[model samples]
Target: EGLEELSKHCFDYAVIDEVHHAQAPSYRKVLARLNASFVLGLTATPERTDGVDAVALFDDILAWQATIGDGINEGSLVPFHYVGLKDDVDFQQIPWRNGHFDIAVLEQRVENSARMAKLWMAWRMHFGSRTIVFCCSQRHALFTRNWLRDRGVKAAAVFAGTGSDPRGESLRALVSGKLDAICAVDLFNEGVDLPDVDRVVMLRPTESKIVFLQQLGRGLRAAENKSRLIIIDFIGTPAIRTSDHSSPLIARRRMQ
Candidate 1:
C-alpha cells in the first residue's frame, strides 16, 4: 500500500538508482515489495561489501564484452600510460578494502593534503590543456578541483551523489572545456562519453580489472592528439605488472 504512493497518477518509466545499496533494511523491504509494471535497475558497485553474495538477484540478465586492445587496435580509442607512484611515499600506506582502495583512510593519509597537491600540480604541468583525473574520494575530488582552480587551470569536480540538475550542469562544463579538468570518484567510468578528454590521471589505485578498464575507457574516445592517455599509478601494484595492466592500458602503451 505504501509503495503504491510512488506510482500515483501517471508514470511511464521507473529507474532504481543504485542496486548495490539494495540490501539496506528499509530499501530491501521497499524493493522486495515493489509492484511496478516496468522497472529498470542500475548500479556500478554491485557486489556485497560483506562477502555474503557476489551476484545480484535480478530476474533477467544480459552481458557484453569488449577488449582494450580491440578498441585501440581498431583506432576507436586512445592508448594508456602504465605508471607506478613512489614506493616509499607516506601516501602509499593507506588502507585497503577488498580490491578497492579505502577512501576514508586514503583521504586522511594522501588525498586532500599537501602531498597530493604537489602530485596533481606536477600532472597539471605535464598535461596542462586537456585531461580528466580519476580520484578516490568525494573530498579528494573537490580538493583537487579547488586547488587547480586557485592555480588558474579552470578545473571542476563531480561525484555519484551530485543529484540530477547539477550533474548535467557539471558534465556539460567538462565536455565543452569551459571546465578544463573534472575530478571524480566513480561516476565517469563507463556509459558516459567525453571525446575531448585527451588524458586521464589515476590518483587512486584499484586491484580490480573491471575498475581499471572502466577508468581507462573514459579517455579512449577518439580525439585530436589523443595519441596517448596518461595514467598515474601511485601504489606499488606488486602482482600486477605494468605490461599486464587493463587491456586498454596495455593496448594504449606504445609497443616498444
Candidate 2:
C-alpha cells in the first residue's frame, strides 16, 4: 500500500525514521521507487544488522554528528554511572539466528526464577527512584512488573499493541511519582523520551551496537533535579565470544 502510494505521485521531501533500516530489501525497494525532490534520513545509528553501513544510501555524508559523550560534556545530556553485572544464564548454549539470539529460547532463559532473583538483587543494590527495566519479551516484562509489585514496588509493563490510552496512563503515573519503575519490552528503545528517568536497567543482552546505544540513550536525556543517570547492564556470555565487550564509556569523565 505504501509503495503504491509512493508510486502515484512525487513529493517535495521524503523523511525516513529509523533510517538505518534503509538497507533492508523492502526499504531499498521503496526508496528506489520514491520520486522526491529531497530525501532526509533520521537515525542515531546508521549501521545495519548485516554490518553494512546504511549511510551509503544517503550519499555517505553526515549532516551533523553528536555522540552521547559529547552531549554529556556539553551539558545537554545527563552524566552517568555505569555498573556491569554478569548474567548467570549461559546464553552460549542457546540457539542463534541471524544477528540476534533465538527469541523463544532467550525468553525461557530470562524467565528463570533463580536468574530473575539475581536481577532483582542487583536492582535492590543499585536502586533508583525512577527506573526502566528493558526485558527481552513481553512475557518477561510482565513477569518482572508483577514481581516488583508483589514486593510492594509500584510498577507497570508497556509495549506495542497495549493501546495508547493505557500506555499513556502508565507513563503519566511514572512521571507523577506514582510508579517506581516500568518494565518494558521494545517500546522504550527509541523515539520515546522520559526526561526524569534517572536509571536504566538492561535485562537483555544487546544484539547490535546500534540498539545498545539507543537503549542507553533513554536515560541520558537531561532533566531538572537529575544530577546523573545510573546504567545497569546485564552482561550475557555469547557462544563464540569469550572476551568481547561493548562499553558506553567513550572519553567521558567516569562517575564514581
Candidate 3:
C-alpha cells in the first residue's frame, strides 16, 4: 500500500537527498516519475568517478562547496586533528573509499578490539563532557556502550536495534545531559539535531560531500561556545579529491 500510494501521488516539490546516488537505476527511475516544477538536490559528492552527472538534471546548479580542508584553511571552519586509522588496521585488507562503509570489517574492528576502544578513551579524556562518536556499524554501537561503561564514562549508544521506544529514550537522555557521548550508525546524521555534540569521532568516512557536511554539521551547532567542533578523523587521508572536477558555482552564505 505504501508503494501504491506513493506511486499515485504526484509530487509537486521533489527533494532528492544524496542526489549523487541518483545515477543508480533505482534512484534515477524515481526521479523520472516525479512531476515537479522545482527539483532540489542535496549531495556532498556530486561528482561520480565517471565525472559530474548532475549537470543534466538541473537547469542550473544553485550552489556548491569546498572540502573540509578548504574550509579549515580558509578559516571558515575549525581545524581538525586527523588521527591515524590505528596501528592494528591493515590498509591492504580493507576496500577504502570516500562514500561507503565496510560494515563487516568495521563492526569487528570497533567491537572486539582495543584500537577503537583506546581511541574512545583518549577522546573521552580530552572532550568527555559533550561528545558524539559516529560508529560504522550496529555491533560497534553495542560494543561502544559496554566499553564506555567499563571505563566509568557516562556513555550511551542509540541505533535502530534499540527498538523504537528505547531509541527515543536514549536520544532524550543525550539531549538532557544524561549521557556524555553517543554512538550510532545512522541516527546522528543530517537533520537529526543534537546541538550539544561538540566532539565528533568519525569511525566512518564517506566520499559524499553531503554525508561529511551532515556529520560535521552535528557538532557545528551552537554549544556553549565550544572550542570549535573537535573532529577526530579516524580514517587516514582526505577520503577523496573533490577539487579536481568541481566547477565555479558559489553560495550566498556568509562564512564569518
Candidate 4:
C-alpha cells in the first residue's frame, strides 16, 4: 500500500538502499511502477548469490567500488584477525544440488559430537566478549547454543520461528553483555548492525562470497574499544571455494 501510494508521485530522483534485493519480485514490481528521472541504487554487495545483476537495474553503471581491504586501510572498518581451523567432516559424501549442499544431510553431518567438542575447545582458546556463531540450520544453532550453555556459557539460539526468545531480545542480551554469544542460522547474515561483536565463528560451509562478506561485515563495524575483529573459520576438506580478486582474504580462503 505504501509503495503503491508512493508510485503515484513522479520524482526527479530516487535512491534505493540495499539494492542487492532489487531483483526480488516485489521490488521489481514496485520499481517498474516508480516514475523517477534518475534512479540510484546503492549496495555494498553488488554480486548476489541468486545470479541477478543488481547493477543492471541502474543501467549497468557502476559509480564506485570498494573492497574490504580498502575499508580496513581507510579506517572506516576494523581490521580482522583470521584463524582457519580444519574440520573433519567429509563434505564429499554429502550430495550437492542447486549450487549448495543438501541441507538435511549437511545438518546431520554437522551435528556430530566430536565436531562440536572440537569447536568448543577452539571457542575456549579464542574467547571473546561478544560472539556470533553461524550455523548451517536451526537445529545446528540450537545444538551449539545448548552445548555452550551446558558448559556454563551464556548463549542463545536465534532463527526464524524460534520459540524461546525473540530476535530483538536475544540481540539486546548480547549487546548488554548478558549473553556471551549467539548461535544463529540465516538471521544475522545481513541487514543487522552488531558493532560490538568481537568474534565470529563460522560453523558452516559458505559457498557464496556475498554471504561470506555479509557475515564478515557484521563484525567489521567500527566500535568503541574494538581494535580488531576475530574470525574463527572452520574449513571442511571438500568445501566449495568462492573467489574475489579484490579481496585477498576471500580469494585466498575461497570463502565464497
Q: CA RMSD for every model?
A: 6.2, 4.0, 6.7, 2.8
Error of 2 at 108 (Å): 3.3
Q: After superposition, how far is residue 123 of candidate 3 from its true place, in Å?
A: 1.8
Which residue pairs does candidate 2 place in steric collision?
A: none
TM-score, ranked from best to worst: 4, 2, 3, 1
lDDT of 2 at 235: 66
Deviating ranges (above 4 Å) for candidate 4: 1-3, 240-242, 250-256
Expressed as tens digits, the lDDT of each residue in 1-256 for candidate 4 is 8877977899999899889999999899889889999888888788778899899988889888877788878887888877677788888899998988999999999888888877777778776899999988888888889988999989999989845457899999999999999999888887788999999999998877788878888898888998988888888776454456234654233221
Cα RMSD of predicted structure 4: 2.8
What's the lDDT for residue 132 in model 4? 96
- Per-candidate Cα lDDT values, in order, are 0.62, 0.77, 0.61, 0.83
Poorly placed runs, candidate 2 (over 4 Å): 1-15, 25-37, 161-165, 239-256
On residues 1-256, what C-alpha lDDT tens digit does candidate 2 reach at each position?
Answer: 8788879998999888888888889888998889999888988777665788877886787777766667788987887877766678888888988767898998888887787777677678776888988887777788888888888889988877642226788889989999988888778878787998999988887766666777878888899899888887766675221111224453232221
Across 1-256, the per-residue lDDT of candidate 3 in tens digits comes to 4444567777668788877777788777776666676778886556654565765677656656566456545664554433334435543456554534456765554455567665765575556356777776667776776787777767777777643226677777777778777777777675476766667776664555455556766765554554456666555444542343222212221111
What shift in Å separates residue 13 of candidate 3 from its native position after superposition?
6.0
Q: Write the per-residue lDDT of candidate 1 for residues 1-256, one digit (tens) a residue.
A: 7767644544455567655556668777776666666656665435444543313555445243345666677888766665444533353465557755666776766544555655665575556356777877788788777777877877777786652226677778877777788888788876687777777777765555446666766777778766776665555433243223342344322211
Compare candidates 1 and 4 on TM-score and give the better one. 4
